[model samples]
Target chain A: MTTEKINNISVTTLANVYFDGKCISYGITYADGSKKSVGVILPASLTFSTGAPEIMECVGGACDYKLPGSDNWVRSEAGEKFSIPGNAKFDIRVAQGFAAYHYICHFG
Target chain B: MTTEKINNISVTTLANVYFDGKCISYGITYADGSKKSVGVILPASLTFSTGAPEIMECVGGACDYKLPGSDNWVRSEAGEKFSIPGNAKFDIRVAQGFAAYHYICHFG
Candidate 1:
């Protein structure tokens, strides 16, 4: 699989990375294509399908995830990768200057 | 028309509201279905069709909009709405700790 950069970010082989405003989730990808998740600060948990075209999750504490399709955001915590299909419908969440994360999805 | 409240917000007859981290755009809904937009703090501009269901936009800065999908956030400034269909694809942008906005979409 190959990765492409849209806004100075590298993404390929979609995976969910978790964080908690402190530590990040251990990196892992299943060969069977399932969902991977972890917890972070603010007692937040993230979950997503390791399946092609990923879907990630996050918890809200005054910040959240931001996807590619909306005007507002879903609340999120510090550490977690929210993955979704490139052409899938989704949103992004940020806490404004206190936290932010990046994501990438692949479709074939 | 009537309004519905979810997560402590009232949404009805979907409309686009603009803000600039200072003054919000004049509330208006054209009789004709079209996009309504304005600018805010970061020299940002938001444009979206004021049509049913609703899709808003926001420019990026240290902060941005946060939609209902994804784990990470796209970049955004203050005062703008990034709207999308109830089941459409999109992303949100926030700057963390500095700002955040709310959104609601009705699909009937």
Candidate 2:
């Protein structure tokens, strides 16, 4: 099921704007100090590198993602998730007229 | 002082995209069921109509706003705020090449 909301957490008021505002995210912290980010990627093809391992959980909309070392592009829709290893890079894209991809990024 | 973060709240995972993605916001709910939103407005001039009264609190960046019936534009920066009455309209603009306006919207 889609995680429509995250309850009882702290949210950073400022946003992280990437790719000239094509992607925006707000940092969130849980009671136990675990960090996550809720973000949206507009219709654009973008490459990203990760420092920590990341689990991208789709909360709304969808995107096609290309994982490291894989030529295959996979679709992740609402309620679905995909993982990326630490110190790796990946590609994510939304079609020009498609809706933005809204996701929760869990970091470890 | 600026509110860098809001603790012990619930955040909606899906984002609200406005002006063709020029503005994006995330809804947040407090324990008492109070609703607020954290948002960023890219460098654009936009007119907005309000249903409920709204207080725009700057968390980062800045904007020049013109309230209803006002011919003058007023600048509001981080740590500043502006209020608009219900059933009213207002104009806000961030200059081109300037940073996006980041704010918390309190509605009543």
Candidate 3:
């Protein structure tokens, strides 16, 4: 398929909420203002194809990440830098499990 | 919400696919076998509430993670370890942007 790299970065602020009666929250948002909020649930393994390149930040715990089409599974800690190819498809296999929060923004 | 710490760690493997003509893939999976695959599209920023405790591994780029109920915004590197409170809710704001992949597993 024909592909072109898109690099348009923008900034977005987040609001913090609680999880239990104690307090906690997690969610995802798209450039179009749509969002997906996730609660404390053990998630199954998942993967996806990239439509745009994204920068993810680790907040609470840690997670393992992998680039599709390669055996290189990169381990991300509480603070790390990583990149996903635009319009590319990849799979992630949670080897350790994660409680980390992320913010996914796009660059046009 | 009523909450309890759930640490049921299990192993899950991921398959790599392509993004462009090159081959890429990305997706998420729940313990019940439900999966959400993300393609090359800039995602909206999101957050969630924790139903279970999880460990996440970072594979590719860099991301910013924040814990719920706190002002602490932790920056995760390529290889680090962190933890999230069970049943807690948190939000992720992509500071730099990411192309990294992640694996999320659970421990019961």
| iRMSD per prediction, in order | 17.2, 0.4, 17.3
The digit string of per-residue lDDT tens for model 1 on A27-90 reads: 2223344323221222233333333565543332334544555555566332343455644544
* CA shift of B99, model 3, Å: 2.9
Q: Which candidate is the best by TM-score?
A: 2
Tens digits of per-residue lDDT, candidate 3, B18-107, equal 221011223344456543322111112446556666444333233566787788877654444356778887654444244432323233
Q: Tell me the spans in candidate 2 whose CA falls farther than 4 Å from its real position.
A: none
Better of 2 and 3 by DockQ: 2
Query: TM-score, B chain, candidate 1?
Result: 0.31
Q: Total clashing residue pairs per candidate?
A: 69, 0, 129
Better of 1 and 3 by lDDT: 3
Query: TM-scores of the first chain across all predictions?
Result: 0.31, 0.99, 0.50
Point out the higher-scoring one by TM-score: 1 or 2: 2
- Measured against the true structure, the TM-scores of the candidates, in listed sequence, are 0.22, 0.99, 0.31
Q: Choose the strongest candidate by lDDT.
A: 2
How far residue A29's Cα lies from its native spot in candidate 3, in Å, is 32
